[model samples]
Target: MNLNTFIQKKINKQLIFPFIILAIVSGIFFMSIGFRTTITTSKIELEKAVEKWNNTFTNMENFLEFLSYDNNLIDNTEKLGEILKNFYNKFQNKISYIYFSTSSKNILIYPETDMINGINPNTRPWFINASKNKEKTQITEPYVDHITKDIIITISKYVNGMNISGVIGIDINPSFLNDILSNKDLLLISKNNIILFSENKNKIGKTFNIPTKSERFISKNILLITKEAKGNVYIVTYKNLFLELLPYYFISLVSIFLILFLGKIVNKNINTELKNSIAMPLETLVNEAKNYLNNQTFDSSKITSNIKEIEVLINEIADMISIIEANFQELKATNEELLDAYNEIEKYSGELESTYELFIEKMSNIVEGFDENTGNHIKRVQILSEFLAKKLGLPKTLVRQIYLYSPLHDIGKIKVPPEILTKPGPLSEKEWKIMKNHTIWGAEILDGDPRLEIAKKIALYHHEKYNGKGYPFGLKGELIPIEAQIVNIVDVYDALRSKRPYKKALSHEKAMEIILKGDNRTSPNDFNPKILEIFKKYEEEIKILWDNLNDNK
Candidate 1:
């Protein structure tokens, strides 16, 4: 019947119960598998810890055997000292001290101790036990050191040579032994039922009575895997099953949640498909028809649907829309032709503007040539002006304007007498007055064109000073256009560096010094302070531009 009812019925009848069953089954299966995996992983980790402890204890036994090989135990004092030094350095953190006890009442200790030579070696349990059993190494129970007062275990071997019978003993910190036992969930227990090393420090040095009956042991829940180390036995216990299964339980919970969430998403998508296949297509066709009636334009693409009734309805609406769209397209084609004609007219207008700009640029160049300025000088000023404008963060359009119009800064020189403009000697005050009026004349010349607005500003105010002592308009500080300020500094710098009719070209260093520090006709005050700072920052770049454009070079 209806799409919504059909989709809901399909999901309820086929999907919901099946998904619920699958979620329950997957969660139970995952928990079973995961719990077993976690238990196995714990067992492997515990075994690794035991193997590591066994390896370390074996190394100690090997070291003791190495020490027993020495025949001249007392006479080879330097050799023994070197051996002890190496052992102490390597195992210093674990072994507090290592010493050799001889039958002659002498003790040689590593990390030298204050014990006197006359002390009896037989009085010590490690020495007595090792000396008694010459074949096997002895590991004595934990004892407080007499000197350091720290808990220590002694690993010793009895040594017998031609004239020597003694014990080679290494006193290890019990903490090092505890580290191995505790890491593996193990306890080091003595034959006397005393816990020597355990993960729980309170149990160490404490005795635990063993139950006589197997039933009692089972009731007490005592389970252990034992490994004998010398005389002591290490007991490994299983980790808590609940704690080990936590991660697996968490994963199972997540999997169930994810399954349920996916079921909801699938149900949502079914409803969405119903809407898209029936309701959305019908709504789109109605809206498109309304848009065609009101706005004379409609989407011509066919409306798609999966439902037979909806598809047939969409086809009928599409046929009516097609006829309306045809009339609209005919009008659209006519309007496009009119638009093309207007664009063609605009293209011709743009070409005329470009021609006018080229004419202005050529006129500016002619004026510069008449003023005895080199073509290269104008080009260099344009480069320097553009650099300063960009460094000052001017917009790209303005920066381009500065580059294009900077050469026109002296266009006013066209009205000045040629002889006066190219004078090889310094100008008199009256002649300077006339020369200064060129700024006013240049502004007037470029005043009529909107495209030359930037050029007009530069021509009028290029000679103006930041400190207000400049000519023509006497504009000061920010009163001058930034474009004019940019061209002014660059114009002055290029003029100083270029060989003019009246002045020889100066070195870049000398020219910069005069520009920054002031000369006869201009000073640092003549330039904008910000512009000056930008010029200084890019001083090297400007100098390179100058050198490359130098006509004399």
Candidate 2:
């Protein structure tokens, strides 16, 4: 052959490999785009569901801790239904039932529940496990609820405080949980594909076999994504691995056909289009993929494009920051200790002078927890009530009672709905009416205790205005008891001073001004003239007291 013929043969050989490489690059680019959408969609859905579940878990655990410390529920379950109703309302419709049980009482399920014999919540495995862990929350395997006769999942925590010893928890309805993972592909299953909640209505509460992990092929194009919840339950989603890939494959075929046609001409414009549009992007994707396999940390920024394939690759890389189920750190009482504490509470019923004192302390904390803006409110109320009672020349015994029971004044809030209690804005007329009933609830809570007579009166009639415009009874002037009158002025003063969800914190001068001179919301006429004079007399000292008991400090 001549020199020209040999050069042409060399050129043809080089063209062959370039065509092959172009085919491969085109396939990869479209392939990545195809799978990315499927992966990203599934991942986002799973992440949201997992995040929701985890949040509920954490909140429930914290609430249980609060319950464990609340000893009042030990003897009084009358208000528990109210408390549960408020809590249930706040959690949307996610919670099916909210209940608690002391060693003395069997579990009381909220909503409609049937009385079931031979079922003691305290003796159950969930309660026992939580009691053992005491401080930590525990989850139970899906089981038939004795009251409802439906399969339900439970999360429980043990309660062992000064007056109470028991378990508190919530039951999650599988159907409600299913509604959260609304996508048809999602299935929350318990052990071996026993569907607790399923995308397909017919598949719910039934067994559906998930094909073997290692056997995923075109004929069985299912992709399984799994995250474990407590109690052998799994959040699972089945996505089609091959669905979008075909469309991407078709795009690749078109691109490949174009590349082949362009290869024959090998013109400048075609080369420019091919290099910029296809070759460089594909090369970058390959480099990113390589780095991902080698690198432990993924920077999604490198994915660099909105292409579905890039998204899919980015999501797969995003797996490093996976949602991890958090476990609690705490302790609980033994069965023997629980039993002994229960027995002792009844055994020492007549000797509750000290326990009552303990309850007062906890009630203050509970009140503050219920309303974050309260800030040493019960403490301040006690001080101001005592100071005013002394100023009134009341007997020492009456003064002592005022200080002791003042903290329990707002104890009736347990019956108020949490939505109203924590409202960030002004209540509607109806809500205001509901809010006013807390006084009645408070009185009822403090009832049955002779020592709490002053507290009960304070709770029931504290809001009765000196001008006759206040709530729950609206008894004007001396019709409102002196004990209530004492707390009323103090409650108003402290409320104006504290930062609430709806209002800014007033300066000490502003608070005193609002109380003495009156505002649209408050009236000097609301205060007894004698109590109003005491506030006017000790305004500076009261300011000092408020500044000294800074909650932040």
Candidate 3:
């Protein structure tokens, strides 16, 4: 051949061989795209089916829960049958039968089936499973129905009440599962690889061999979606690969011819179009990142770029923001919990104070009731002590302590003999000495209780004279606690105005006269001069209190 002809033939060979290879690759790519689309569509449909099945299972579970709460159905065969009939009517097509069995082996079946009696339900799998799982509903392994010969699964719940307790069961027919699979070749397999149900009748009740890596076509099996329901695994398989790829096969042939015509021009335009598509979206992404950093919030939904890389980055940022938001919500919940705890502590403190006040009032009543002074004497003493303490410019907390504790000052009188207390005449010197021991007795009674510190001090020292001549310890001047000193004056003033078994009730003016100036019976030197001065100043207020308290008389 001539040299020019040889060169032209070689060029033709090079061009033809490359075109053939490109056509083959293009055909493979188009077919792969079609297969991916088919798999995606199948996955969506499988999810919908799985969700429907899950909803149905949830409905069955809810119904079982409802039956468990029916106390009337438990142990009452007639009521149980009535309820079962209602349940069967409500789900007649989906359920094969409804029955109940008690712990005592008594069985009740709806639709009036004649079964053998005296069979222990505790030995049954449904009862055992329901009893074992006390916290949730239980589902038994699939079994053939004795009457209809249809495959069925039983859902059971344990019933609990005073006199009625047993297991309630409902047999569900899985025939309706075919509608969820939409006539697809789906198998409901147990965890042990036993096929519970299948679209193909022969496959049911057979052991299934799960596909291994070597046996499965990874690309074709992408259409298979496995979902779990009530511990059973469902495998949905899509076949017919060739029919799904037919349209792509024709389109690939057309693409090969177009590629030969436009191959040289396409490469130049592709880079330009790619840059235009990516540039604006990339810039927008950068601006969004800046905004997210600056403001700590980003509208991820607004980021709708078609570029794969930008979309991926946007999704990652959205995930990070979601994590931060979740952490913020958790922190907010923790803060609310802390606030609740603080409020609880405050409520407890107020309740404690109120309880302390109530206890003090009760103790005062016991002492007064025992002493037989029935005209609100303890109440008047508490009021008068509180008034004197405040007028003496004591701190509010100390004044409150004095108010609550002063009423219990004479609790020692309980130890005194009733005859000695109720005597209408002056006592013998020995009896008077016994009466003086009440102060020591009151102190002993109130001691060791940290909550009654003021009560103990007042009870022990209220009779101690300011000049060191009083009974008990004989504490003088500032040596005695101010609480006791305040109560001492108030107690004596109330006693003078009150009618005692031993003495006529003195007038308020006479009581003040004896307190301010020395009398034949008592002297001003017996009280703290400071407390006595404040008392004289507020004597009118004290008289008003006595009059008001005595008004009930």
Candidate 4:
């Protein structure tokens, strides 16, 4: 077969493999999207279940307060029984039973119409827990009652009106939660290690043993969620299968194997055709070209090939080489001129760099003239600011800017009277107000300098507290630029460490203790709690930087 004919046949055959791969990849992508959507919906439903349970408890609590007034508080067992019976009737299908108890003692049991509340469950695990535990309320797992044998979740609360009085407990059925957590096989375990509720019926009320494979993947997620810390939600997803997609995976794997087997047969056929069409023709052309070069009389008319493009390209190349030899001397002269221009451009670039350096040096001298300490302070603050910015996971460009602009931190202090700058005593209220204005003054100095705007913003607002009690403008929380917040922490660290006219330098440990006490402010006005937490995390490194800067000085 001709090489072109073989290649065309192979190209048509390759189309089949690509289409099959696309179908498999598309199937996986769609399945992934569907799985994620199901998980999100289930999460919303779980939240709703929690909300419904909370509201139900609140309603029962309101009833407990009302019943406490007339019913015997000292001998509440019989009265509680009657009250629970009423609740069962009121909510009907929503609530299955009402059981009241102290952590270790059962006060009452009331059952739904479908359940039998014949025997008292005073000694049951949930009842005993309700009677003794002083915690507000403990919700129990799903368990079958002794006589009625229906599954239910129990909630208990400690009674504190007069004396320790014991706890009141309520039981709820979990059939409503099943519809919501339908996406995954879910298991709700109690604090006592009993499975309270589960979509997987086989697991309900059973003790959980960590499966060997799931130990690493899901154990930590389960632990974190069970704690129920405010705003603490966790995802414990792992591989799973749906009823519909099971067949797709099986079929896809079989298809891949069959395609692989067929691919070997196709490849063998293509290889045989390549030897006859491509390899044999290329070898023949190379041998003919070598023979003509050895004979020394190259005639273009002697070379003819069945491949049309290769033949045309060979004929044009021979003519082109003859034209190149004729023009070689003129081309060499023009190349020399281009080299000279490149050298001149390099010289100009070097001069520009030298001029830029000289400008920076002159500006540095003028800005930090009075104290050599001013230069070191700027450099150190910039370093510290950059460190803080990076530690907080800021973008690289932002961190670089903070480092470059921190020297302008005290640019506003330049406007303060020299006497105040070196004052040995605490300033009066009026003088203090003047000192605080340095931030505002510094901002104005760098305001129009496009180069220093971010630095100016830091200088202007870094001293502002998280609680809106800070000066110039009482910008609070995230409203205060992160750059300013970062500079604020470093500024305080530097201030406390440096020898001042009024107070002795504070120890690094003491400085850290005060900043971290977080007693700074939240409601009244002060630093952000979350931001403060970030600062505290890097305290050790911050202290190291402070020590290094002081030593260098």
Candidate 5:
């Protein structure tokens, strides 16, 4: 990437997080320090202010004692007049007045003077405070003098060491104290910690502006001040004003952190670019190879970019894929040859199944023809068995299996001597016993064939009676499989309806009555009673199926 793009990406990824983090951390840090600094500085300033005011009042008290006693001048009215006149001459224009008053009534005044010397002291704020607190001497809070029109502090003392004393007060200008405090470089702040008035009053009440590099000055002051306090009252020298170097040190530390963070980011970008430069050529070649193997064509000229290594790799991969394509054409021809051979085998397999079906159909016709009264009797039995099995809700696989295999029920009769099979009279007990062995013969012929194992099971067991009476094995109820029971009912129904050489075919109603009659639920029963009931319910449909088989055959 170009330098600008690379730098932009770096800024987006690296700078945004750190910048936001710095802003949040710095904002919280600054606010916490600012709050603590303001509290500490304001507390210190208030303490100093109270101490200054107290000391100033002490100084003014000592001055009042000199005029009251040490000079031995102002004892009564005449001496006070001499003292006031002398004070005016020595102090020149700066000196103002002196006062002497009674403890209660203001009728008598010291020096008995009006405008120039003593006057009424009852209306003064200091008079009220001195009288209440019984102060030896006290100074009131600054207020404007009525005559001078200037802010001053008033001092007073009790006369005669008792309640009735005259007042000696002087007005000290506000600028005298202001000038002394300014030389100490004290910053007078408001309740909110904004600079209210400072030595430079031009910027009074303005917010304190410290450079970003100078912010640590305030932060350190708060820490130092908090450490020095012993109890509620303590004093520290001007430690905060000397704290201005801290911000410069902080700026140096931040510069180091910035350089290290940016260096790591730039190194990571350079390493990633070198790695991509090495890997992209191989990736492009792999893509080109895949496209060619899929039989897609592209111009060689299009692959010629500024990257020669990738171009050469792509060209080689394309050639290799073209070789694979040619090999695939040969493989396709061989696959076609094998496909034709497989189709031929599939045709022969289909013919074998068809031949098996045809043999069963021809044999079924021959067996039914032997009893000419009920034509196609085996086919009718197959249809009736399916219908009854469906009505009984037997699983469909078992039903269709029984239907397809039921025609082979008489396949064992092929082994029976023709004279016995076509006999006009009833079989003797010995011959009937021989005849019952046909079910065994049928099972024997179907055994050992894997594909027809299920069909063989039905064929071998169809003659079995549910009551264990009508079979070679005499299998009992539930021992006889359900498929066997179903085939047994349809087998008997078909035999009853067919005209055999030995007996006439019975009507459908007569056959259903025999199949569904009493004691069919007991052991040795010829067929299942439940299956017989299903057969009876569909007797009309069963008759139609039987008639259709006869007509078709």
Candidate 6:
């Protein structure tokens, strides 16, 4: 009645519809059998009667031929009458009367009636028809006898004897043909649509309203099955098709009722089985799972089922919860120990990182030849590189590496002679050659230490120009390491801005102009185009770094 009940019965409805189909199919199957059985049986009975009717006509003709051989038997009217009387006694059932007539107005009809006075042999239908056709006896088609109103056919033989020269005729009543089938009703109908013979005597004299173009057809609410018999039709009529198949119809209705009954019982059994085997256990599984998740209480034994897979699933869920609970306690202790160990490692990492920074700054200070101004100069380069690296969106680890290792770009100056370090004048060509060796020496000093790998590249390739001309190795453009290229631009900027021994520190604007548009000493072509763009875009940020970290600060 409600939604849940309707939905629960949904499967029952789906399962029950097939029984409706089965009932319909069985009904059609039995109905077809009934129709074919009734119609086929009726047709077979009609055919048998047809054969009997043909045989009767043939027997009559044969009898007439045998009688013609006995010339004396047929030549004398007195003897012929005696002979016909004997045949009349023998076949009195099918023969209403037997007669022998000649051309001389002499006629003898057995059980002679006063009607015989009106019957003339010379002008009778039998004599007039058979006398001219002498060899073949002419048998008239089945018709109603006018006097007796019985269905009859007349057969006549022309006998040309020395004494008797006339026709011998017999009048037959063929109503006995209806006795062929005891159960099936049959009719002998004349070609003129007259009912000649019928089991129902009332129908014997009626006109059969035959359909226009069919031997077997439905007529006047009757299914007519007919066979041609001696120019007449042997008919079997079924008045009502439903009444004929009533037995099968009753059986089909009973079968459909039984199917519906069986379907109801099956659906009930299915629901009961599902409730016991699956539904109740699934409900328990949900309830138990909720209790376990909410409160730490689990009792898998409460989930009961007859099905093996359901039992196994419940057991697996219980087992998994048990394992997770046990592992949780162990995991709590393990995580505590790992946290303590992590704190110790991070503490050591901070101290080690600070040591590396102190070591790098000491190295940069040594490379400046203990000069305060140059010391501040390298420190400013570190700040600028860190700021620019962050603006470039470099990863934090890479930015930290660039910030820490950038000041070590001139660490190779440690190997340079002190005269060129603070020459206060232009270097000789030989001293300039010695000056370029600082990049190679710086690479050698920071080499083979992975922690300072970027430092090594900056030292070795920082002097390499984007055009590949300002280097010990002449490494070109992108052939220089990106960290080295970054340091190269930073080194030039600081060198132009710092109060160097050869020149006064240029203003930030003057230095930016010289870097973007070349001075005689420096060219825009010597720097990586990407790093150059960043320097131009963030020139204001670079100016802030220079002012904040200057020697005065």
Better of 2 and 5 by lDDT: 2
List the candidate numbers ranked by TM-score, top first.
6, 3, 1, 5, 2, 4
Number of the candidate with higher lDDT, 1 or 5: 1
lDDT of candidate model 2 versus the reference: 0.73
Q: Write model 4 residue lDDT over 444-549, tens digit each, in one string.
A: 8778877767878987998887777787888878889888887877777676666665667779887766676634322222556665777678778877887887
In candidate 1, position 524 carries an lDDT of: 91
For candidate 6, lDDT tens digit of each residue in 173-288? 64465454343467666566766556666676677776522656764446667666653344444446767789999988888888888988888887777777777788788888
What's the TM-score of each model vs. the native?
A: 0.40, 0.37, 0.41, 0.37, 0.38, 0.45
Better of 4 and 6 by lDDT: 6
Candidate models: Cα lDDT each: 0.76, 0.73, 0.76, 0.62, 0.59, 0.77
Q: In candidate 1, residue 75 scores what lDDT?
A: 52
TM-score of 3: 0.41
lDDT at 117, model 2: 47
Give the number of the best model, judged by TM-score. 6
lDDT of 5 by residue, 263-295 (tens): 557656765664455344444455555665575
lDDT by residue for model 3 over 330-386, one digit each (tens)?
899999999999999999999999998899889888887777565788888888899
Could you give candidate 1's per-residue lDDT for residues 151-227 as a string of tens digits? 56688898765565678888876667666655545666666666766667666677756532121122233333344
- In model 1, the Cα lDDT at residue 272 comes to 83
What's the CA error at residue 135 for candidate 1, in Å? 99
When summed lDDT is taken over every stretch of 10 residues in candidate 2, the lowest stretch is 323-332
Clash count list over all predictions: 0, 6, 0, 17, 3, 0
Candidate 6, superposed: residue stretches over 4 Å from native: 1-10, 65-75, 101-106, 118-169, 181-184, 205-223, 231-240, 279-305, 308-553
How far off is residue 116 in model 5, in Å? 99
List model 2 lDDT by residue over 1-553, tens digit each: 6433444455557775698688879888888877777677777887787677667677777877777666776446677667777888887477777877766566566664557445676666566667777757777655666766666667888766465577777887666676667788777776666676665656666775764232222237877677766445677767777664677878988988888777767644545554554445455656665665577444556545545674675576466335311211112335667789889987798468668877787876786577556677888888878888888899999998898888878887888888888988888999988888889998888789786788899889888899999888778888888999899888898888877777888898888888878888898999899888988888787777777766533
